[model samples]
Target: MAVAETQGIEPVDLAAGSEIDEYILDDGVFKGGMSTLRTATNSVDKKVMIKFFVQETSYQRELSSLYSLQKAESRNVISLIDYFEAEEEDEWFPQSVIVLELGTVSLQHWAHGKRPVSEVYLKSILLDILGGLESMYTAGLVHCDLKPGNIMQFTCPGREQGIWKLIDFDCACKYSAI
Candidate 1:
């Protein structure tokens, strides 16, 4: 992987025990209101995605929300492998790195292509989305930013390709008590 200066700081190189390594920053593939997405390889040569939060507060909010979802252990939600705060001398605030499983593609990309998916696949994706939403609802969290980009496709064993999963909890929030 090539090294480049991002936001005036070098990409972080994670050490052992971090569950991931060779943390080289790649081109930003997806951009969201709270974070930028890049692809990376983990220790075992598995391809993963890293979400680099632009601000510390945004990082904290996302971490907290993910932690809640983690406790739920919902399969429909994105699986967070690990996260850490990168310590850098040149940076004012440490960068929070959230490692997630790399999806085959985002739903947005598929939809934008204007190709029609099989009805069975479409139903599967829809059910998966609702399942994820129900899990969030059970945890008392609301996924405020539900969109095609936030919904990803992955290949599941014993099933055809394009199994969809809901991702991105940066803007997710707890429901207000009534």
Candidate 2:
């Protein structure tokens, strides 16, 4: 579908527009981490998943990740398409927002990693993810949070299948020399 086409999904209304968007349905994502639903009304008619830096400990690194990925290639890494800060703040958390491609329902959703995703498919996902990481590493960045919640799956309407997208750069620190 054209990027200009608005996917029919509704935008996650941030009552206060902050780091934690209560407007997004809690059920939108598979995990407990903060989330925001991104509906494209003008392009790409579909639901875009957004993960937030709900925790304060790793927030700074997110900025670094965003900057590092800015220089990386498109397909290998989860590109940082755009970013915005919500002037509206929650009673408690700081106002912050980062846009990224939505990952899959959660690889471990089946049984806490017990029910493994297809080996062949999983390998393909990891390839893309690692390539991105390797590129980041070359650029002198360290993505500390390499857990399940941080990896999202990217699927397009025209594409026959989806690919794994490494996300949540909130914990990605610049440990290497630029």
Measured by lDDT, the strongest candidate is 1
lDDT of 2: 0.53
Q: Which lDDT values do the candidates have, in the order given? A: 0.73, 0.53
The positional error of residue 52 in candidate 1, measured at the CA in angstroms, is 0.8
Per-residue accuracy of model 2 over 46-163 as CA lDDT, tens digit each: 3344544454444446756667676766365576645555333432334355655555554445227455568976677678678867777776777776876566656756655566
Candidate 2, residue 119: the lDDT equals 91
Off by over 4 Å in 1: 1-7, 10-22, 25-28, 86-93
State, as a TM-score between 0 and 1, how close model 1 is to the true structure.
Answer: 0.80
lDDT for position 150 in model 2: 62
Give the worst 10-residue stretch by lDDT in candidate 1. Answer: 11-20
lDDT by residue (tens digit), candidate 1, 43-162: 667778888787777777778887888788788888888887866763533567788888887889888866677897788889989988988887789988899988998878987765
